[model samples]
Target: MQRVRVSSQQAAVHKLGDSQMTLSPKFRLPAARSTITDHALDFDNSLTGEPLIPGFPDDVALQCLLRVPVDQHTSCKSVCKRWYSLFGSKERFFTLRKVLGFHDPWLFVFAYHKCTGKIEWKVLDLTHLSWHTIPAMPCKDKVCPQGFRCVSIPHEGALFVCGGVVSDVDCPLNLVLKYEARKNRWTVMKKMVTARSFFASGVINGMIYVAGGNSTDLYELDSCEMMDPKNGSWSPVSNMRTHMASYDSAVLDGKFLVTEGWFWPFYVVPRGQIYDPMTDNWENMPAGLREGWTGSSVVIHGNLFVVTEHERTKLKVYDSGNDCWEVVEGPPLPENICKPFRVNCWESRVYVVGRNLHVAVGYVVENYEIATGGNGKKGGRFCVRWETVDAPGSLFDLTPSSAQVLFA
Candidate 1:
């Protein structure tokens, strides 16, 4: 049997025997700086003195530390230099979590205050059912929600907030900011080649891609670019067939799909485009797919699902074989989860955040059934169970613009 001391001041001890190890109830590390930016400039990374936990091998200690809840990491890092080195470095802490297959999905919502118009980010820990506030984005200029696009590389536990318009001036920006979940820090990354807003952005093969958005002069841009996050550099990609701005976009089956969405006047069909990284080219989206795309889209289990924009929001799944969308069997979007909601999914759950930060979780059933519509068209049918999570009263004035899921 081995005994490990977690904290000397607290005199907390955990016994490691043949069975699994559990931390002592009193084992609490000292509190540290809440935000990385507070001490990032003066922080030291040199490891010295003791192992992560005294009286245990470093490797064995790591397994015990890995079990710490992510929310407690800030406090745990303050215990010692060795512990800080383990949790402070993304390549060390986050990469190990991925290797060990300890993924806890957290939803990051980018929202703005309705009265003040100040933008901020809030994270929902799906596992613990709690909320955490991250460091403010490092943008010098005031910006509005929906103008910038947020995308994440889930496995790496990183999120990128790309170009957006200035709140007061409406001028587009090329700025990009990255937030590392494990470090609880934000780092501004290399700017995009072109300043853009309301652009289409997504991750393909671990690379970031942006295309067809409004420029500084408010003209729709036909330009596109790709960035390799490893080096924080951007390269030009083939332009779209026509200058277009995305109303909705999704990465499905490793391909990037962008649709302008149907505009009013009811007769003119919206234009859509598809980007294939392998071909380094763009193609027109199929008429059936683009015309029927009426709302926000999320890809789950390799299938495209959309929450319609109409008065009574309904969930619909795309049928690639039939090239059309069929409404899935599920409860209508919760009355409380009102319009202008942002949607994102992880595994089989579809998360929708509506006005005032209210959330609706929809679980999609895997075994789909074949059903015939009134038009006698065959379509796949799946069932969804809906549940709602209310936002804290303090955030009642906030409205979400975008949401992304990251695993840590």
Candidate 2:
């Protein structure tokens, strides 16, 4: 570092004997008379440390910043003003967001660079298309279990991820991994009672519901459990009448709706069942769904809507009062692209995300359109369009190749 000096009285510093350090009359001190007086004794200089730098090449310095995991990256910016400026810049901040959004919208995706054996996590921000990586967890194995699946359920402001099989064959896992958005780190939670994979889990009424898993015998589990995040305990619920293995469940109208799973060893269940936790019972909703009924069910606009992957699947709105399914018309995409669309209710609208190909390379997002027919009616056709990648679209763009729907 270069050293510079100046007189204590001046605010600016200068090198010794530099032209700017000339001592003229302007620098002259006041002359003292020959009279002496009693003086007070005091010598204190406690406040002395490093000075703050006001400016830095933020854009340039930021280039040196490797994307750290989300949990620890914030501290890197907090180290100093220069670092803070570089990391918190609008561009860099947004870039981190995009990374998190694409990695796994639901905060489920974990990445391991086998070469370095570094494990990291990417969390998606649904509102704003962005990415956030979690700090490295203690368990650093590069391999995740072959059939591991992660689910994130929002509690308060944080998201709790639970029940994934560990990579180690000797010690297969039923451990719960939690990612706190405010803290930005992954903390291991209490393990589950049963070890399983490919199950359906979600939060409903301050409790997490986990059900249906593929067991060692290739048979699906009919059992279900409820987890209380507050108490850190689990309890059993009424098991399904039949095995709904590898099924999807959604909470609507104070009831849990499970749909589209293999009823038999190989055939898919065309029936829909509604489970009421309040009543501790399950009621068969109806027999069959429209053909190609792949999308998850959702309750929206004071009604329940069953959307199909294709436009032809149409909109089947259920009237709870009348006990019936009504079809609404609209523009729809190809059925193959999203036979089983992942449906989510955000804000006041219902959104659907589906991949264009079976390989799951590309995806699209669209809003369900509602229309009115004759006599100024309130209902008619419902339609959806593809969401562009550059814009908020079907795929959560984490990096160039990997993508998923935004969830955070």
Best candidate per TM-score, number?
A: 1
Deviation from truth (RMSD, Å), model 1: 9.0
Error of 2 at 228 (Å): 0.5
lDDT of 2 by residue, 1-408 (tens): 323443578577753234543334222221431211100000001112212232422222232342343335567767765345434443444333333332323423443333443445544444343445556654436334323444444323345555544444433346666655434456777767766666667667878777666654546677778888876687889887767544465667677776644332335446555678999887775554322234455555545565544336455555555555556444443344343344544333444444321212112122232222234444433433333223123323222211223332
Pull out the clashing pairs in model 1.
none
Q: What is the C-alpha RMSD of each candidate to the true structure, in Å?
A: 9.0, 13.8
lDDT, model 2, position 323: 57
Q: What does the lDDT read for residue 84 in candidate 2?
A: 59
Cα lDDT, all candidates: 0.80, 0.47
Candidate 1 Cα misplacement greater than 4 A, ranges: 3-101, 264-267, 368-379
TM-score on alpha carbons, each prediction: 0.78, 0.56
